[model samples]
Target: MIDRPRRLRATPAMRRLVSETRVHPAELVLPVFVREGATEPVPISSMPGVVQHSLDSLRAALVAAAEAGIGGVMLFGVPEHKDAIGSGATDPSSILNVATRVAAEEVGGALVVQTDLCLDEFTDHGHCGVLDPLGRVDNDATLDRYREMAVVQAASGSQLLGLSGMMDGQVAAVREALDDAGFTDTPILGYAAKYASAFYGPFREAVQSSLVGDRRTYQLDPANRREGAREIDLDVAEGADIVMVKPAMSYLDVLADAAASSPVPVWAYQVSGEYAMIEAAAAHGWIDRRRAVLESVLGIRRAGADAVLTYWATELAEWLR
Candidate 1:
C-alpha cells in the first residue's frame, strides 16, 4: 500500500484539524500612532490603511481594537514640537503619555496599554538617542532619558513599555526606574533584535521622522544572525518581561532562536515595510491579499513568535473570529 500523505491536504477541515500552527485574535497587537494636535485621523500614504489618530479618534480606535479582541495596542506619539533631547518623551503632558491616560480610561481592562519608549519619534534629529556635541549618539546619556521616560510612561498608565532604542543597558536602567518609582508591576518589552533595515522606510513616514542618518550605529546589522541571539540573551538578563524580533518575516531564524531560549514571552513585529509591500502588491493584483496576509502571519507564528504586532491586527482579528 502506498502512503497517502495527501490525506491531510485533502480538505480545509483536515488542514485545520492537523495544523501545527495557528494565529489567533488574542495573539495580535495593533501599533497605533496618535498625533499631538490633529482634530481628525491623518492617513499615512505609505501604509494604506493606517492613520495618525487625533486624541478623540484614538479613543475610538482603542475601543475598536478592544472589540476586535486583539491582545493590545502599542502607542507611538507624534508631537507638535521636536527638540535635541526629545524632552517630550519624558513630559507627563506629552502626546504619548496623554494617549496612555486616554487608552487606560477607554480600554484599560479590555486590552494591554503599551507605549513606545524610544526618542526617535520625539527627537528633532530622529536618532533613537540623544546626540553628543560631536553629533554621535551617546548611549549612557540616552539611558538616563530612558529611565525618566519609563517612570513617566508608567505613571501615565502604560502597562507595558516597549524599549526600542537599542541602547546599551536600557532594559536594566528602565527596569530600575520603574521599580524605584513604585511601578514594579509594570513590564518592559525589549526590542531585542531590531535590525537597521530598509524595511523601516514606511515607518519613517508614518511617524514623520526627521532622521538625518541611518541607525546602523545602534541597531543590529541585518546580516548577523548570531548577534540577534546575543541581544535577546542580554535583554533577558537585564530584566525584560518580553522580548521582540522586529521586521518579522525576514528574521524568522533569529526569532526562532529567541523563542527557543528566552524565558519570557517572544513577540515579533510585522514592520511598516512588510505591511507596505503586501498592501502595494495587493493593489497591483499580484497576489490574493487575504491569503497572503494570513499566510505571512501564520509563518511568523510557526517560526515561534508568541504574539505579533501588525498593522493588520484589528482587521485580521475580525477575520479570525
Candidate 2:
C-alpha cells in the first residue's frame, strides 16, 4: 500500500490537530510608545497604525491590551527634552517612569508592565550609551547610568526591565542595582543578540530618534551568527531572567540556538521594519495581510521562541483567541 501523508494535509482540522507549533495570545507582547506633553496621539507615518501616545491615550491603550489578553506591554518613552547624559532616563519624573506608574495603576493586575531601559530614546546624541571625551560610546560609564536607571524604573513599578542597550555587563549591573535598591523580585529582559540592521529604519521614525550615526560600534554585526550565541550566553551568565533575539525572521538560527541552550525563557522581537514591510505589502494588495502576519509569527514560534514582541500583539492575540 502507498503511504498517504496527504491525509493530515486534507483538512484544516487535521492540520490543527497535528501542528507542531502554535502561537497563542499569552505568548505575545505589545511594544508601546508614550510621548511626553502630547495632548493627542501622533500617528507615525512609517508605521501605519502605530502612534506616539499621550498620557491619557496610553492608559486607554494599556486597558485595551489587557482586554486583548496578550501577555504584556513593553513601554518606550519619547521625552520632549534631551540631554547629554540622558538624565531623563534616571529621573523619577521622566516620561518612562511616569508611564510605568500609570501602567501599574491601570492594568498592573491584568498584564505584565515592562519598560525599555535604554538611553537612546532620552539622549540628545541618540547613542545607547553616554559618550566619552572623544565622543565614542563609553561602555563602563554607560553601566553607571544603567545602574541608576534600573533603580528608578523598578521604583516606578516596572515589572520587567528591558536592557536593549547592548552595553557590556549591563544585565549584571542592573541586576545588582535592583537588588541593592530592594527590588529583588524585578526581572531583566536582556536584548542579547540585537543586530545593527537596516531593519530598524521604521523604528527610528517611531521613536523620533536623533541618531547621527549607526550603532555598529555596539550592536552586533548582522553577518556574525556565532557572536549572537556568545552574547546570549554572556547575558544568561550575567543574570538575565529572559533573553531576546531581535529582528526575529532574519535571525531565526540565532534564536533557535539560544532557545536550545538557554536556561531562561527565549523571546524574539518582530521589529519595526518587519512590521512595516508586511503592512506596506498588504496595503498594496501583494499578499493576504492576516495570513502573512499569522504565518510570520508562527514561524518565529516554530523556530523556538518562547514569546514574541510585535506591534500587532493585541490584534494577533484577538485572532488567536
Look at candidate 1 and give me any clashing residue pairs: none
| lDDT, residue 114, candidate 2 | 97
Residue-level lDDT of model 1, residues 27-55, one tens digit each, is 99999999999999999999999999999
Q: Which stretches of candidate 2 lie over 4 Å from their true place?
A: none
Worst 10 residues of 1 by lDDT: 1-10
TM-score of 2: 0.99
- Per-residue lDDT for 1-321 in model 2, tens only? 599899999999999999999998989999999999999999999999999999999999998899999999999999999999999999999899999999999999999999999999989999999999999999999999999999999999999999999999999999999999899999999999999999999999888898998999999999999999999999999999999999898999999999999999999999999999999999999999999999999999999999999999999988977
